[model samples]
Target: MAAPRSVEPADLSPLAWRLLRVAADYEQRTVEREIDDILQAHISMLENGSRALSPSRCNTLFALYSAELTEEQIRAIAENF
Candidate 1:
C-alpha cells in the first residue's frame, strides 16, 4: 500500500508527520521559495518527525495545499499539536 500523504490527528507525531507529507506534496507541485525556506532542515529529520512547523508556516502551507479548508479546520489541526 502507498503511504498516506496526510497525517491523522491520533498519530503519535501528528503535527510533524502531517507537515512532512504536506511539505513534500507542496514541494513537488511548485518552485515557491517559501516552501524551500520551511523545509530547510534535512528531509530525514522531517520524515522522522524531529521537526515541527510553526503557525505562520502552516498558513503558507494552508494557502498552498488546501486553500478551501476553513479556519475551524485550521484550528482543529492546530489542536493536534
Candidate 2:
C-alpha cells in the first residue's frame, strides 16, 4: 500500500495560501450568518485541496473579500500550483 503524501506548508503555492488566508479572514469578519456558513465551506475546500483557486473560484473569493483583482492576476494565482 502506498503512503499518503505529506502536505507541507512550503508545498502550498503562494496563491493557495493567500486564498486560504483571505477566506479565513472573511469568515472572521462576515456578519451575515448564511454567508458565513458558505465561507466556511470554501475554507474547507482550500485546506483539503478538494478545490483550488481556479479562475472561477478566485473570482468568487475576490468578491467575498470585496477586493479587486485583474483576470491576469487571477490566472497567475490559479496556475501557480
The whole-model lDDT of each prediction reads 0.46, 0.46
lDDT of 2 by residue, 1-81 (tens): 111123233345545545644543545235234243345556566656676645555444445443344444434444565
Q: Count clashing residue pairs per candidate.
A: 0, 0
Determine the backbone clash count of candidate 2.
Answer: 0
- The stretch of ten residues in a row with the least summed lDDT in candidate 2 is 1-10
Q: Give the clashing pairs for model 1.
A: none
Q: Spell out the clash pairs found in candidate 2.
A: none
Put down candidate 1 lDDT per residue, 8-78, tens digits, no spaces. Answer: 32342544445544644644225245475654353335445676566565445545544434444444454
Q: Give per-model TM-scores.
A: 0.35, 0.35
Against the hidden true structure, what lDDT does model 2 obtain?
0.46
Cα TM-score of candidate 2: 0.35
